[model samples]
Target chain A: MSLEIEVFATLNGIPDEAINNKTVIVIDVLRATTTITVALAAGCLEVIPVLTPEEAIEMRERLGDERVLLGGERNALKIPGFDLGNSPLEYTTEIVAGKRLIITTTNGTRAIRRAAGGRLVFLGAMINAPAVAGLAATAATDITIICAGTRDRFSLEDFLTAGLLVDQLAGQGEFVLRDGALAARDYYYCHRADPAAALKASFHGRLLADLGMEADVEFCSRVGATDVVPVYGGGIIKKAS
Target chain B: MSLEIEVFATLNGIPDEAINNKTVIVIDVLRATTTITVALAAGCLEVIPVLTPEEAIEMRERLGDERVLLGGERNALKIPGFDLGNSPLEYTTEIVAGKRLIITTTNGTRAIRRAAGGRLVFLGAMINAPAVAGLAATAATDITIICAGTRDRFSLEDFLTAGLLVDQLAGQGEFVLRDGALAARDYYYCHRADPAAALKASFHGRLLADLGMEADVEFCSRVGATDVVPVYGGGIIKKAS
Candidate 1:
């Protein structure tokens, strides 16, 4: 039998047992996972995802201010003392190269922490969809795609990003897409021709645009913008070799 | 501002607060809500929804088995000794007319009970999409559609049924679709031309086929097969007139 690929519309929607032995692919396309992929691809040494702003601050203190940069957002804006906000375009090689970054956000980081029990956890977004799907195509265990929706609710951006990955992995012809994945695959095919239009239709996409962050939406909507798949292990995310 | 209409992929995926003071629509296309709509359209008195098989038995005894029928399924098969299974075709006018039904299912009935917090709880299926959407169009509060997914996991059959409702409610031009609703509307439109094919694409639809219940699938997939909207309140579901 082929591997099973399932998509969850939100982090809270997933059962604990689904992650225990599966290869988990996490998507937060509006920004968190997208930003992580951009930061790692821009040459950041590694990113440590923290759940709260206070934890991000503490990580900065413990890792020493010289090499660790704080990057995150609260309500889609930069934290008061953080070096960067949660925009993928903000993480250029000039700023992030060779640095250890600590990040936190409203939804994405919490999902990463929740997937810690998985046999393997890889952060995915539109920018890194095919690379992440390639990882799934080679996994020994079944794959679970978890969308890090905004504030315990569904986010279309993450869901479509999950769909894009599903489309890619299913291309290997060794997958049995399950319920959510089954739905997502069809949605992906419907919107594949114009993904940016799909992203602009998302609630978070409009939320970001309302906050004058359309550039972030524009940046995150590009498929295969980079080939970096950030794998999470031992409490940190780094571009897979 | 357009009235907000949100779609939840599963009963458990929704937070308790999402249903309060809202108009909630529950769906189980394969085939709890479908069966309920069929039974009511065939002139059944009312459906008493219970959470457990034991509660169904208790209800049958308390209501006096002489006039009451036990109708439910566990794992898609008729519960042993029950009068009917969770199939739309079984509740013919000859069998269900003028009788009270105590019904339970693996997903749908529980979803109806869980939506008790809503200002109004209505059961939906492809069989009653237009009528249920008419109810939402006139609802006093924002709407929440809970898909009675299979065993806490997302089910496309319920989801596409939800999308159908979303499409119809949005047709009135006063509803603002939220994240899940936005995604659902797209999926619904994609499959609207041929809804039967869409149901056949669902995980549960194939499961029913595997179990020799293709007749139920055929029955449930017909859009607007009946216009009866079953509203659940105070522990019983009845035709909304």
Candidate 2:
């Protein structure tokens, strides 16, 4: 029997039963997962994914503010009084290295939390797509790619990232692609040539451009730019050691 | 300003604000909407979409069952005690003509009801896509295409049907394609040549084929085969007059 893969454009409407026994790849390409990938690659100790900005603040208080940094966004702008925003480029090695990162966003963190039933949950984005897919393929018999769509709506950027991962994963071995996977795989095939253009065309991507964060979109658009696959367990995400 | 178009793979997360003042096109190509279009074209008096088989039966009882037909499916099979299943082939002129269809399905009917806030609601499928799009473009300044996804998950056939509608609507006039519309439009572009193949590859399509309904899939795959655009108003759907 071949492996089975399902892709979800958003986390809404997914039943709890769908996640059990499957390995999940959570994506929020513009730019929660992308930012997390960058933070981990830059040597951040770990990422604490909370659902809301208020929760992020509370977590920071409990963790103590010394070596921890808060990062997130609402409406594509940095949260007030946070260490950083959702832009991936802000997590340079010098800025995030050796720090504990607590992150939340308008959509990504909630999606990560809701995908908790999966036996294994790995954060995947265009930046670490190839490596994430390579690692995830061997993790379980079933794989679910859950895209953190913008504000509970299907975001094109995340769906496209799923397509990218599906395309790469298809090369590994034979697999049964479910409806969402088939759609994303085909969409990825259609838009794979110009990932950056695809991102720039997305709703969040255009919003980011309007906010002068095109650099973030460009940074998140580079497929396989890094090989860091952040795994989540017990509400914490860390680089696979 | 040009028209605005947004396509939803499923009706789950659509906000009421999104539907306000927009013409909505509800699609369920395999085969709720397809069946409705066929029944209407065959001269069914009207299609009253209810949420459940029980509701369909109740509605039939309330209406005195005279010249009334109950049609629906559960898990793509005929609902028990219903006069007909969801297969478009069964909704022939000989069977449905002059009858009132109290119709229900697992997903399609709920989608049609949920789009109640729309300024105008039109059912569009591959069978009558071109005419629906042409008429819908003139009915309102904004259009929202809602796909009745299979069991609250993204259904490839519905998405493809939405893509086909988006593609046809694009040709009718200039429009600003939102994220969902852009994704559907691109998906349609990828698989426009052979829709039957697309349908066969979907989760529900394969199930119907397994249940000996390959002919139904082929029947729904033919684009622009009819000009019957069913419009829903005042809780009843009838051929556009």
Candidate 3:
């Protein structure tokens, strides 16, 4: 079987063919994937991704707000009246444990929805790179890694996370890599020694830092920090059992 | 001042915003840019790029057959009755010197047309990377390097060529790089010691080799082999004087 690393530089860049019959790993390391991994690890029962804030709120109402927490962000800030912003730190055990999260985001959720037709969809980040790669290697079909770039443009953080995953997947078994995969692997090697430094220099990283979220970049760059692989199916994400 | 390397994995991947108000360098190093650079270096007066074979034939008819030569390929093979195939070797001084050529191809010309709104457009390849970078550094606006990916899919060769150009441009001036540019530069550094080896392993390169075009890949991988920078303006490409 072949492994194709198809990076959608932005949510809008994903091609229709990428979402069909493939094992898709969606990454938005700047926050979304990081947030999901942390939430699941903190014992959140499930995370439902919606494209819009209204949809997130509606889902929360349907599930009963007492049992569901509204989460997500717009323009890198928490949505008004929502329970959480996109930061991974916000999904603490005290707040998220034992509850369901109805989430929407500026980029990541849109990308996840776009990959809804995949045979298997998983949320990946540096935090869960090895775990995702291990699961991905056993897939019965081709694997595609899609990056949730920032604001419909290329985001360095997402591509770097993809590179880390590609590197891990390559080590697990032999597979034919697409050009994008090769490129991502090469990029990962270039920054493998110092991912935080690489992230600090990225376009989105700098933007986030300017917004006083530099700690998030440092947190997101910690490879293999969590073993949680959040699998998405039937409209919700839950830690794979 | 900034230099952005916007890599479109395929022609279909280019964003609408990437084509405006920038100095765009279009690279299709597998053959088109290599051929165009060679044609100009061997003394072709001008090369006009069109999206279809019929457009090339019509342009030749309008300009008279004696003054215009039809040159291009549909599937790495010459169109029947055309003056030349899409090979740099076919653009010898004896046949094409001082003549105008109308060219079309499966990928490159379409990418060129896509960048038509740019303040300046130039054809780039490994053969003319330094030359293109030198010219691009002088642009009053930002420089955007666009990879004409293979047949609506990402091609390894084009991205590597873009990386080479980004590396060259980075050395010549102070410029902020976009995430795509950073990825390209890092990729180039990973394989800078052996570009031909990297190209030979690419999907398109292997396909071309199977078709007995191994020599073309070797020729196209030669960095700084030519000084010709083919500038596109008024819908025609000519060696920048």
Query: On a 0 to 1 DockQ scale, where is model 1?
Result: 0.69
Q: Where does model 2 exceed 4 Å of error?
A: none
Residues A151-197, model 3: lDDT tens digits: 65667788888888888988887777887787788788899999889
What's model 2's TM-score?
A: 0.98
lDDT of 1 by residue, A29-125 (tens): 8899999999998999999999998998887777776989999998999999999999998999999999999999989999899899899999999
Cα shift from native, residue A197, model 1 (Å): 1.3
Q: Provide C-alpha RMSD values for all models, in order.
A: 1.3, 1.3, 1.9
What's the TM-score of chain A alone for every prediction?
A: 0.97, 0.97, 0.96
- Please report, as a residue range, the 10-residue window in candidate 3 chain A with the lowest summed lDDT: A1-10
In model 1, which residue pairs have backbone atoms overlapping below 3 Å?
none
lDDT of 2 by residue, B13-85 (tens): 7878778778999998999999999999999999999998888888888899689999999988998899999
lDDT, model 3, position B15: 65
Flag regions of model 3 displaced more than 4 Å.
A1-13, B1-10
The structural similarity of chain B in model 1 to the true chain B, as TM-score, is 0.97
lDDT of 3 by residue, B108-207 (tens): 9988888898888999999989999999888867777777886655677888888888889888888778887888888889999999999999888898
Report per-candidate DockQ.
0.69, 0.80, 0.55
- Model 2 interface DockQ: 0.80
